[model samples]
Target: MHIQMNDIYKAFGANQVLTGVHFDLKEGEVHALMGENGAGKSTMMNILTGLHKRDSGKIVIDGEERYFDNPKEAEKHGIAFIHQELNVWPDMTVLDNLFIGKELRSPFGLLKTKEMKALAKKQFDKLAVTIPLEKEAGLCSVGEQQMIEIAKALMTNAKVIIMDEPTAALTEREIEKLFNVINALRKEGVSIVYISHRMEEIFAICDRITVMRDGKTVDTQMVSETSFDEVVRKMVGRELTDRYPERNPNIGDTILEVKNATRQGVFEDVNFSVKSGEIVGVAGLMGAGRTEIMRALFGLDQLDSGEILINGQKASIKNPFEAVKRGIGFITEDRKNEGLVLDFSIRENMALPNLTSFSKNGFIAYKTETDFVDMLIKRLRIKTESGETSAKNLSGGNQQKVVIAKWVGIGPRVLILDEPTRGVDVGAKREIYQLMNELTDRGVAIIMVSSELPEVLGMSDRILVVHEGKISGELLKNEATQEKIMTYATGGQ
Candidate 1:
């Protein structure tokens, strides 16, 4: 089947989100939708999926016009969406979440729990995963939650599957497994609409790519005919030669040190140090204790036995408040749950950790709080309607910027970034890299944990490889290679 979206025009108040945008997906083909944050990609997709009614558009499925009033209507027509943010309840079991809206019910108005559980098992088996169906969805890791979302889509027997950043939280192994599943779906004549900021994944998995820019359809072309740089240029409206900002060579004395850091079953005996003005990239396969170490250092988790010294003086940190007081900040990987407050405004979230700076008489100084947030928004280039806008309203990239802006406003001496660019676009990633450079130039040390090898190799002054909850090896900037890092990451050291 071929799906055609023609003359799609949508508007929110005075903002014209999509101006005559168009997209197409062919049968059994992986079609990629590429654009920068707030480039109208999501708006266009929302229209197609029936989450929002289009002001003007024609959706043609195999020459027949279709208009879906709601998401259930779209799903009934074999169209399914796996949203960027995970949509599973922590309180519900995996089985319940998988069959949430489309539960199997008996004719007598009773819930058919056993049949739904059995059906969930079948889908998991097809996906080659073994998640405990009875376990709470919240207990599962982010990667597992992602897997459950995919399985939920499959339960609808969807002919057209829309995946928005499906692999953003997945490990290398999980990504491979997901790719295998996608390949299997293609063989069965299922079409895919893949939206992601990762260029490599688009080149590897997609057949055609549709580029959108500033609420307009820029171009649609085959993957084999176009280049990655050309696509990036189309999205950002500029030529980006250097994917990462040039590294600053100025290094100084160690600013933060963790000696013999241990967190029991989480990690063991970790030893590392970050120098002032240095960007230390931590690399390892998933579950290699990289995140755990950062968490412990940030006082999110208490180290079972370890010594943390800041600038040659031993420091005691019992919680995040203490960590912040000690001039340390962490930009967590799970931004939605850990790094941001969805209900709070952009300025409100920024004012959270640094409220003391804006208060003198126990009452918040709204003007001071907004001024600080405004400055950071400008410095970080965060795209928002206003500082009063809710954090949830901003795009993924902008939300990430807000998180950084909050920490930077606090003036942390040492910043810990966990997957800083996991789901952001190329333009945002480059901008963030530049921000990192600026921070380091100001003598603020940074410890970055990343799963992307190229990002680590390009931006870091040094690399630390972790394996099985241990610091397996360390490599200088010039000496580190993907192969060498992999060797150490797999316990070669």
Candidate 2:
């Protein structure tokens, strides 16, 4: 074995995140770590990378027993990590970013600019990547940035590498290229620990799979010996026959419509409609205008030209406040930054959208606000000690529920959910899916934008595939399939 972890226990106060977690890795092998949100996968990675001190545990690397005080120490031992959110200098060129700390210097310790660019080009060429070494890292797309991060890790000649959801923002072709790069790394006898929620990818790329549930290792087996369903059962502890709830089948009158929507360079000539009680899913690769479309509809962005019709009446939405006033709710993808007020109490945040409804003659009524928030807390099944607790105190899944509940409190006619379940757990995902069903049954229109193909196919009554800032194809619920959606997303013939 190249690396071994034993009885790793970590906790934050009373909440034990990881309990006696054991894991092992061998050279020339790709090991996968699977778990739900808040299941301690990230915590364990942080421990390995020396970001967090474990309460108790023993970590062995290459037959040497050592403790890492920080990530620099881990790097000194040929250990590197590629996080989901990449770490790259946006303002600097590729060469500058690659040699930021350890630069190519002359004998007098003078900067060697020529050597840095040459080495950067060599690294990219070796990885079969064509990223311009002189170009600014910030100008590259997310996929290109991921490649740069991977190239940076490989530059260290690290023996052990850990990647966390590296393909979360990549397209199908980009993902395939990443898998090829990983295979090349494995051929070089490097040990890799891959973490992701996509089961298909785990089975396709990993040599060994380890399932973790509620902070403990449940099982670890060779990838060839296990089936996908078996892994799902172990990870979730239940059979999830349906990823999405069944549609109501009967269609209602159109509640929201956009005609010839044009946002100049963003999206152009877009036309779509969502009926009352219908769930319309918009799927596309990253930067394919999915989120941009939603943002424009909710007035978070300016549209060069478009006509928005609400319930057969022309509506003009110039800002978010006006959007909310028109009975339209938007739950943004960036929950931490845009969806919730981290420092505010849950009760206070929940009353933000419709605070006027809780006020009498401009005077707020605390008792009435508390009562309504209490009801929302119960209805959403939010796992929190009290409504007065800060939003940051809750887990990711619970915080997401609070965001949804906050929008639901406004009693919206049309809901636009952008990656509503992006970082949430499986159980929380099921709850959110069921909540969507309940809302549609009550005659609410939902326009959802998600990167997960299964979710888009399962939950939507209709699917619209956007490509290069335009609607490439549209499919009814029965006609939508993963392969078909992917074809449209990539501009397939």
Candidate 3:
């Protein structure tokens, strides 16, 4: 399939999303769409896939102008979108999810279970996915769920696949497998619209790149012909200084410590400590109990047998409220569901944790709340029309900033950040790193659980590697390398 989108324009009320955006995808090629959050990359793709209607544009597919009425109609014509958030029905079996809404049926109106399973197995085999078809989709790991979505698209015989941030939650090994499948799909004449914030992955896989900024096309170049610096400049409309901000340590005494923290089946013997004005990074593969340990610390999950010490004194954290009251703030990995209320306005979401501070005599102070939200918005450079705007309307990077801002509002002594910059762009990532430096400078201890090796090495003062629910090894910032981290993460000394 060959597609050309010319002069695309879209607007929601007073907010203009896309204007004169041009994008094209050639058959059998991996095309990258690079941009900062709210630069209209996703919006343009949504228009292409018929999820959003374009006000004025020409969509030329195979030399003919075409506009799909809906996503299903677009999929019927061989276009499939695998969103960043995988859409897997938790209670349903994997087979059911794959054949959802398009199940095969016999002449007597009975379901064709055998035929569906056979077809699903064939697609899974092609993608090298080993997930059992009988297992519940919700039980699958993020990587497995991603593969299921890919196999589901392939099962539709989709010649054009749009993958949005496909590897955000995947481990290194899982990412390699996904790359292999993408290569195979390209060879099979499947065109891909690969949208991601990871520059390394973009250069590694994409054949051609299109840069967008402020809802307009900036430039399009072959990946081999363009440089990373050049693409970033095009995307952000300026030269970004560093991928990570500098960290000058003023290490203090331990602020929080977990001694033999055991969650039984989830994690075991997770011993670590973070000092005031220090950033301790937890490195491990996905499902290596990295997130589980953080959850236990934040009181989201109970630690079966362990000790949590705050400031050299035992602290009991039975729930999120208690965690917050003890000055321990948590920014969960899954921001959409856990961190923020999507339907609420930015002011409301930011006030959820700090309402006590903004309240007086059992009455809320609206002025104080708005003032605080406005300050954080400006401090974090969150791009939004106003604090009254819904959280769901902002881009991924902005949403992440909102999450961070919400945590910062409580004035925490110790902050736990899980995958802080998972799907954020390069510019916003640097900003977040700068924010971390500022927090540490203000005597805030931080425990960052991350899967990205460079991020771990760059921002952490100390790195702790997790393997099979245990702390495998610890490395100082000066000694930590990607190879050493991987070794420890994979159960090496």
Candidate 4:
């Protein structure tokens, strides 16, 4: 199947999201969509998937023009979308989830449970994964859940599939399996629209690349014809000379110190010290205690035994509020649930942390709140319609910025960021790095937990690898590498 989108234009109120963007898909090939945060990639895909109606555009499928009213209508034309966010319910079985809305029923008004299980099993087998058909979907790991999502797409007999940030939460082994599945699907002549922020994945799997910037389609070139440097330049609308911003962290006195931090069945005997103006990067696999350590330090989790010292003096944090008062800020891994109130306006979300600073005698100061919100929006380069817009309306990258802005407003002596650039694009990532550079330059200590080894190697003054609830090894910035980190992460040390 061949699909073409010409001169797509869309807007919401005063903001023009997509302007004269053009995209097309070829049969049996994986097409990569690359862009910075708020570059209109999602907006364009939303229009293509029938989630939004284009204000002006033409969609031609196999030389026939068509317009879909909704996602269901689009599905009838053999389009399937496996979103980055897992849509499966925790309590529901894999069999039930795979055939939830579209079930296999007998003509006599009876459901075919056996057949549903068998069909789902078949899909899993093809992907070389064994899934208990009756097992609850939520009980599965993030990687298995991702495979289940792909199986659901195959159940639809989709000719064209869109995978958005499919490997954001997948492990190294899980990622390899996903690539194999993609290859098998391509062999069967299925078209795939692969959207991701990882440059390696684009060059590895995608045949054609399309770059968008500021709601416009910039360029689409063959993977073999372009270099990573060129793709990044076009996506960000300028040459990015450095992937990681230059930082000469002025290592000062130890600001935060952890002594024998232990959490039962989570992490144990974790010891580290973050000096002022230093970025300590934690590198580990999923469930390896990186986030667990941070949680314990930030007062989000109970510690079996630990001692926290701030400014070389013992400090006790019984709760998050106490941690905040003690000059500690945490950016949680789960942004949607733990970080932001989706329904709240940007104005409320950004100012939620500093209400005391912007208020007096329990009376909120509207002017002070607005002034601070405006400053953060500008400082973080957050793209939004207005400060009044809901946080849910922003892109994933921009949503992350809101979380950062909220914490940065608290003026913490030490900041802990978990998966800081998980799903954000390259351009926004550079901006975040710059922000970190500026923060460290201001003499604040930062502890970042990330699964991306390259990111850990690039930004950290030091890298700590965790393996099975223990700090396996620690490496200075010059000594850390992907192989060295994995050696420790896999319990080698």
Best by TM-score: 3
lDDT of 4 at 294: 90
TM of each candidate vs. truth: 0.95, 0.88, 0.97, 0.94
Cand. 4 Cα-lDDT? 0.89
Candidate 1 lDDT by residue in tens digits, 184-301:
9999999999999989999999999999988899999999999999999999999998898778568999999989999999789999999999999999987788888898888888
Tens digit of per-residue lDDT, candidate 2, span 1-493: 3888889999777677889999899988999998776677878878988999989989888798777899878887888898765678989998888887989889999999987778788888776778888899987766688788988888888888898877765666678778887898899898899988777888899999888988999999999999877887887788877656666655699999999999999898899999989999999987898888888889989889989999999999989999999999999876766899999999988999979999999899989999999999998777666899899867566778889999988989999998888656565687789999888888899999888888898899999999998899999988888999989999984
- Model 1 alpha-carbon miss at residue 491, Å: 2.9
Model 3 whole-model lDDT (C-alpha atoms)? 0.91
Give the range where candidate 2 is weakest over 10 consecutive residues by summed lDDT. Answer: 242-251
- Which stretches of model 2 miss by more than 4 angstroms? 86-100, 103-114, 121-148, 340-354, 357-402
Pairs with steric clashes in candidate 2: none
By TM-score: ranked, best first: 3, 1, 4, 2
What residue runs in model 3 are displaced by over 4 Å at the alpha carbon?
A: none
Overall lDDT per candidate, in order of appearance? 0.90, 0.85, 0.91, 0.89
Clashing pairs in model 4, backbone N/Cα/C closer than 3 A? none
